[model samples]
Target: MHQNPSMADIKVIIPAFNEGDSITKVIEEVPDFVSEIIVVNNNSTDDTFEKAKKAGATVLTETRKGYGHACLCGLHYIDKRSKTPDIVVFIDGDYSDYPEDMEKVVAPILNENIDFVVGARKKELREPGAMTPQQVFGNWLATFLMRLFFAAKYTDLGPFRAIKYKKLKELQMEDKTYGWTVEMQLKALRKKLTYKEVPVRYKKRIGVSKVSGTVKGTIFAGVKILGWIFKYSIR
Candidate 1:
């Protein structure tokens, strides 16, 4: 087992919407050395907030109802704190990602001082049906555009990512919906932040994905992602 680095101040932010069933498992699996786990309950009608709090997470509520909105809320919460963490990690509330591999996701930043690290869900590491066909095609299309436009090496806009808190703030992230992940990557490229990808395991999530499972959600997400890519490409 790789030991957690004691010196690094790491905080994890989870944006959840009606993820009560899988929130606790996600929190419980987080490595112990993490300084804090902040679960942003994104207007979940269910008991997501309660379950996360019960699991010992510092839960916050974001009534705005967007993935970026919830993540921004967590960032605001951290910004208000007297002691800022060295690194911030963003992961899903669903149990699709292996929380235990957080150590690996943050390793490049912790050891090599990389500005950002993305936990790439490589095909070999992902379980069957873990990603929908739309999700797969979307990732491929987005990354291909990124490579063509910016000479970026990003393969997946995976949410399980880590970045230095200072660099993250420097990016001035403003996406409030499906474009959040790609916006970060594009901005990181624009700012010339050193980044690395670490292949990680992925499993089927406990519940249906709010974004990829529904037709409307998938279409909106695709449009938003493509919009960001084109907007940045022209700049």
Candidate 2:
């Protein structure tokens, strides 16, 4: 069993795109045990950056508009930090995820020697219409494909996740779009990393989802997710 480390070393990375209304709430709800909160504003045309900064989160700007790009920007900032965190958590800035449940998300890693954990937004725990039909279908299809191809047991491609900083670097994540979450899961499988999922609560976001709220965003996301799965399956 891994030594239970102080939760103080935990850092949070929130990939925000135009989440002006919800960023502050998201940042504030994060548990006090966390060390640093990093929010990557993905070319927002609103006051997202200013609000996040004012909310006491270390904010960075990623002009390139993609979830993965914003996440990569946050990771890059952490890479330059002098003291590396023991665990890094990724949550959305849209306030859809319960930030307080972070303790549960990182528990296995801190106590069970697990290398990674993804917050599974259980259908029962999610608010009505929290996840679009396409999102639900896409998650099922992607995870089903992973199981069929790799015998991997995964349920949700949830954004609220935790991973050891060292193991995260080992994955060499490179997805710059919708493929981000699946790419991490796929690479973790390829590396045979110990992982688990903890159920997390989900609610409707404060603003319209750029991806699930629009037809174009939904189609692109579906294609990107499928493309990643097929590409890795062939490897």
Q: Please list the Cα RMSD from the true structure of every candidate, rounded to 1 decimal place.
A: 1.6, 1.4
TM-score of 1: 0.98
Per-residue CA lDDT of candidate 2, range 47-121, in tens? 999999999999999999999999999999999999999899999999999998988999898888899999998
For each candidate, what is the lDDT?
0.95, 0.93
For residue 109, give model 1's deviation from the true position in Å. 0.4
lDDT of 2: 0.93
- Models 1 onward score TM values of 0.98, 0.97
Residue-by-residue lDDT tens digits, candidate 1, 1-235: 3435567899999999999999999999999889999999999999999999999999999999899999999999999999999999999999999999998999888778799999999999999999999999999999999999999999999999999999999999898988999999999999999999999999999999999999999999999999999998888
Can you tell me which runs of candidate 1 are displaced by over 4 Å?
1-4
Clashing residue pairs in candidate 2 (N, C-alpha, C atoms within 3 angstroms): none
Candidate 1, position 164, lDDT = 96
